[model samples]
Target: MSPNVNRLRVIALYKELHRLGRDYPDRSYDFNGRMRRMFEKNRHLTDPEDIEKAIQFGEYIKSETLALYSLKKYRALKRMYPSDDKH
Candidate 1:
């Protein structure tokens, strides 16, 4: 994907995460946990940075397409729930 597309994809994930975090104030832990699970489960759906190597060497490894489940997303989630200790 293009840089712009990747950026937009990240932004969309950010927005979705933001909305999820905002929607369930009391169940934030559950929400975040679910998100984390989803991340872990789909950690291998696409090869973001190694497309060429994957194709050339036939070493294709399915990686999670959702970059939002990354560390950056965790940071953002922490920022959103500053007072939450569910982590």
Candidate 2:
């Protein structure tokens, strides 16, 4: 892909992560600020390979975050409807 395409892709990923981070289980964590700093830290990455690798890592983070959200929801549901196991 062209450099412009990669740039747009990165921006989109950043925005998605920013939005997802709004409900990041830990309210004290500055997710948006941290994310901004991370992206700024990589502002010098001109190599396509490096950019691709970083993008892949960002995708991984998104997946992990979703997993955490799912787990939180599951825990809430379990609390609301406890199982009747007498073990």
Candidate 3:
């Protein structure tokens, strides 16, 4: 992929991560700080292969975070309106 495309993808991932951090169940600041540190740690990477790997890892993290949040929401909903079978 082109350098421009890679940069854009990185930026998009950064924004998405930060947006999701807002809804983190606890330690929002800690999460955000860790996210920023992860990016910063890779800021100097010049190898295309390494950068691509980082991007893929970031994407994976985003998906996992989404799934976890979804599960949490589902659990909350269940608690609020448990199934009749349980009763």
Tens digit of lDDT per residue, candidate 1, span 1-87? 775675565445645654555544455367656655654554454666753333322211112323334655688888897695678
Give the clashing pairs for model 3. none
What TM-score does candidate 1 reach? Answer: 0.33
Model 2 steric clash total: 0
**TM-score of every model versus the real structure:** 0.33, 0.92, 0.90
Give the winner by TM-score: 2
Clashing pairs for model 2 are none
Winner of 2 and 3 under TM-score: 2
Q: What does the lDDT read for residue 37 in candidate 1?
A: 60
lDDT of each: 0.49, 0.91, 0.92
Displacement of residue 36 (Cα, Å) in model 3 is 0.3
| Selected candidate, larger TM-score, 1 vs 3 | 3
Candidate 2 TM-score, C-alpha based? 0.92
Task: Between candidates 1 and 2, name the one with more favorable lDDT.
Answer: 2
Give candidate 3 regions above 4 Å deviation: none
| Predicted structure 3: lDDT | 0.92
